[model samples]
Target: MSVWDELVGQEPVVQTLQRAVEDAASMTHAWLFTGPPGSGRSNAALSFAAALQCEEGGCGHCRSCTTARAGSHPDITVIRTDGLSIGTDVAREYVRKAALRPALGRRQVLVVEDADRLTDQAANALLKAVEEPSAYTVWMLCAPAMEDVIVTIRSRCRPVLLRTPSAEAIAGLLVERDGVEPELAGAMAAASQGHIGRARGLARDPQARERRRRILALPAGLGTLGDCLAAAQSIHEEAGERSAAIADAADERELDDLKQSWGVEERGRRPTGYAGSLSSLEKDQKRRRTRLTRDAIDGVLLDLLSFCRDVVVAQQAPRAALVNADVAESVRSAAGVWTVESTVARIDAIVEARESLTANAAPLLVLERMMMEFLPR
Candidate 1:
């Protein structure tokens, strides 16, 4: 077995890192791994960190490799966020950790999984750490694109870009790793458009598959203005429910932890400044909820866009395979009715709505505009 086994369809990236592990001259103190969603950027970073610590250069069975991959390695620090941003405090804390020597491994490795979420102050704090690192320390930053990272930080790191894996590769992984039936695995791979996480989700979760079916049905149902508004409201409500499902329990637990830390009981008298701390925690939770909500809405937009792409393909090439092949009937119907230009315009509108959501635009309004524009012309 190899440490790179799980990193499917990224041979070029594997080769680059392997050479660095073998030859010191090819190694760099800082590395950047950039890829689209589900391209396995963080997995690559973790694998590289494991290889650097391994005596046999990432023998998959070694303790070092297993520990690193499981995120239990003493010398590896993974900086990821569930909140909206990584602030200066977190950045500085990791920087201080990064200065220490390897506890038991060959090198100290710090992997920043969401480099794009770093605020300006946080980025500045990291610049010095990446610019002049300890001889035995390495920094790996992962982001969606090279440009997503701040210029000053990325400039100091070696670049490795990962591409979307092919449907064949994704399907093979699903079958081999998760024991998904081969036929369902192939279908989920195509549906996910090389998004490995999404492919697995669709394969393992019947509800996710059902939710996708409903989202794909939207274009066909948008025949009137009321339909459009209703669709937008439905999408917004679903986003709220889904985000709340993920956040509600965690929010309550966090509040409980905070209260306990302040020595305040559920029905006890208030402690001094407890209100301020509670307010801060609530604000953070709200920000996280907002991020989760937008993420949920964006997933809907992406599904719609994928359906639009299939429509474009169907119109352009009548015999081509669609990404959403499970809904071939709908794809063909839409393709037969809508002109290529009209379909393309709606694709543009959905993409714009995704961007608007990322920019903190109102979800209902952005989605309403998007749904309205998607009406058949």
Candidate 2:
């Protein structure tokens, strides 16, 4: 297996990067990888980074390939933010870091996995570094699409686009790598609608599958204003609770690690700098929690969109396969209750909810409004 093996269904992308590796003339200081969520654009960027660092062009068994993929290579840095945005402060710091020479590898590689989240200021801060990197420095940025990246930043980088993986491709990966049953893998792949990450989650996590089922069932039960309102609240609160649970667990672990480092306990004497360090970590954790909460809500919105789209497919193209095939009865019921126009409107409403949530609207209010939009037409 090569470093590119994990990039399922991206043969064209793999070919481009491999040729670049063989021909230095095809390589550049900066590259932008664009695709939809779960298209593995980030994975492509990372594999490309490993290939660049690998002496034999990314033989998966090489130390260079292994360390780079595991994020342990001294010369490679991955900027991944779980928060809402990659702020100017962090971007500037990384720009300075990237200016340094490689210590132990062929090049100094920096991969920004969520370049689309860069604030305008952050993008501007990165522009000069990307435009004129040090010799052997490479910048690979991944985003959902070219438009998601700022024009100035994107214009300076080579564009590598990844197509959404087909269900057949995703199912094949699940069977090959994850050891999932072929039948179950196909079902999850179709349900995830080309989202490899979601497909994995659906196949591995019973909770994820259950949550999807609940989201798909919303349409048939949302018959009244009260029902819609309640659904909105239910989804909002559930997402919040789920995010909080994850954050709490992570925070607890960090807190323990910090205390161990400082040699202090909750009831013991505080170290000289422990209080300030704790405060800083708490602030950072708060940002992460906010981002996670938004992410959870966004996921629910996507599932709802998929269900509505399935209903539309049932109405207009009766022979087309539905994403939520396991919930065919729910999809058929929704198709019967709503006209094609109404289903399209519901889809539009879900899109609006996504946009509103991104704009920092109150989650409960946005979900409530979106749920009411699904009320009987």
Could you tell me which residue pairs clash in candidate 1?
none
Q: Where does the lowest 10-residue lDDT sum fall in candidate 1?
A: 368-377
**Model 2 C-alpha RMSD to native:** 2.7
Off by over 4 Å in 1: 267-274
Instruction: Single out the weakest 10-residue window by summed lDDT for candidate 2.
Output: 214-223
lDDT of 1 by residue, 222-292 (tens): 89999999999999999999999989998999998998899998788999999999998898899999999
Which digits, one per residue and each the tens of the lDDT, describe model 2 over residues 1-377? 88998898899999999999999899999999999889998889889988998889999889999998788999889999867789898999999999899988999999999999999999999999999999889999999889999999999999999999999999999999899999999999998899999999999999888888888787788789899889988887887798899999999999999999999977889989999999977988898898788889898898888888889899999999988888888889888989989888889999999999889899889988988888887
Model 1 lDDT, full chain set: 0.94
TM-score of each: 0.95, 0.90
lDDT of each: 0.94, 0.90
Against the true structure, what is every candidate's RMSD? 1.7, 2.7
Clash count of each predicted structure: 0, 0
